[model samples]
Each structure stands twice: as C-alpha cells, then as structure tokens.
Target: MACGRFKELMMASLDGEISAEDRAQLESHLAECADCRRELDELSELSELVGEIELPRPSQEDMMKYWPSVYAKIERGAGWGLLVIGVVVWVAYGVFLFITDPTTGSMTKFLIALPVVGALMLLVSVIRERVNTSKTERYKEVER
Candidate 1:
C-alpha cells in the first residue's frame, strides 16, 4: 500500500477504529516504513496528551445573551438597508425634479444629468467588478 493509504489507516488505528484487515495492512506497511512508524508514534502521543486536557464550559448567562446579540446584529443590518433605500429614493426624486423643472434651462439640465449619469455608471462598474472578483474567488476556493 502507498504511504498515504497507510497514514489514513494509522489515524484510524490511533482512534482504535480500524478493522482487522486494515490493521494487518497498516502493520505490514509500518514494518517497512520507518518514517510512517515515527509519525504514528508522534500522533499516538499527541492524541493521548490532548485527551488528558480539560476544556472550559460556557456560562448559562453567556449562552442566554447569544441569541439577543445575534438579533441585534441582524436588526442593525436591516436598519442600514432601510436607510440606504430611503436615501436612494430621495436622490432619485431630486434628479427627477432637475430633469422636469421648467425653470431650469436645457444647458443647466444637461450639466446636472451629466454628473448623475457618470455617478451611476461608476457605481455599476464598481458593482460588476466586485461581483466578478467574488465569483473568481469562489471558483478558486472550490478548486482547492
């Protein structure tokens, strides 16, 4: 068997979860591979040391606060979303006024529209770039 396969078996053996057939195969591999044997020894010792350690438990009060903390974060996000929507609606109304107001000359209207159009185009470009970047990063993560 290859070293990789034997290493898997070694891990199972350390956990005392290997079958008789796998144990026999692993033992034979360990006899021939001193490096694997050394690794197995180290893993065994580490597992034993870790098993002897104690972990702290969370307090009941802390556990009770967890849900409220999570809800507060979600509430904050929703509040920000509504704020952004309100600002966008207000800006759009102002832009509409600039476009439709009879008092504004054609040249003045064109100048106002120019900045709004440029800003919208820049926003769209930034959103597209971010989306493409996120997709590429997700693909790389999946490949790994």
Candidate 2:
C-alpha cells in the first residue's frame, strides 16, 4: 500500500475499526516501514494528549461578551456587500446616462441618486433584519 493508504489503515487500526485481516496487513507493513511506525507512534501520542485534556463549558456572561464583536463583524460585511452592490449599480447608471443622454447633465445627477437611495433602503433593511435576529437570539438565550 502507498504511504497515505497505510497511514489511513494505521488510524483505523488504532481506532479498533479495521477488520482483523486488515489489522494484520497493517501491522505487517508497520513492522517493515519505519516511517509508518513513526507516524503511528505520533498518532498514539496525540490521542493520549487529547484524552488527557478536559473541556470546560463557558459561562453565559462569557458567551454574551462575544456577541457584540460577532454582530459588528456581520454588520460590517453587510455594509460592504451593500457598498459593492451600490457601486455596481452606480457604474451601470453612469454608463446608461453617458450612452443614452450624454448632453443632459440632469440625467447624470438622477443616475447618482438612484444608487444612493437604493443603498440607503438596503442598509435600513439589513439593519432591521439584524435587529430582529439579535432580538430572537437574545430571547432564546434568556429562555435557556
């Protein structure tokens, strides 16, 4: 077997999931292959260390402490998404104004307003949705 296949078999062997026949084959290979033996030992040591560590639950306060940063990051992403969409729309509008009515400066001004108004509307919607979601999550947390 290739080194990759052997390593997979070694992991299965350690997990006691490999059949007896496959276990025999892997053991025989491990005996001749120093690299496989080293990897198996490394895996065994890692499993031992993992087994020794304890997992502790976070307090409610600790969990809530992270909420602001998470919400801020989400809002920031939404803001950027809105910005990108608005810019694309603005560029398209500018192009339309240029091609369809280059002589009219008012058309350009109107085109500029389209993205600003649309972006403002989208920003409000995003903020509203975020507020609703945050409220629902807070309710669920309180219930728990």
Supply every candidate's count of residue pairs whose N, Cα or C atoms clash at under 3 angstroms.
Answer: 0, 0
Candidate 2 Cα outliers beyond 4 Å, as residue runs:
58-144
Which candidate's lDDT is highest? 1
Model 2 global lDDT (CA atoms, 0 to 1): 0.86
Q: Scored by CA lDDT, what does every candidate get?
A: 0.92, 0.86
How would you encode candidate 1's per-residue C-alpha lDDT over 14-106 as one tens digit per residue?
A: 999999999999999899999999999999999999999999999999999999999999999999999999999998898788778899899
Best by TM-score: 1
Candidate 2 minimal-lDDT segment of 10 residues: 135-144
Q: Which pairs clash in the backbone of model 1?
A: none
lDDT of 1: 0.92
Model 2 agreement with the true structure over 80-130: per-residue lDDT tens digits: 999999999998998776667757677676887799879989999999999
Model 1 deviation from native, Cα RMSD in Å: 7.9
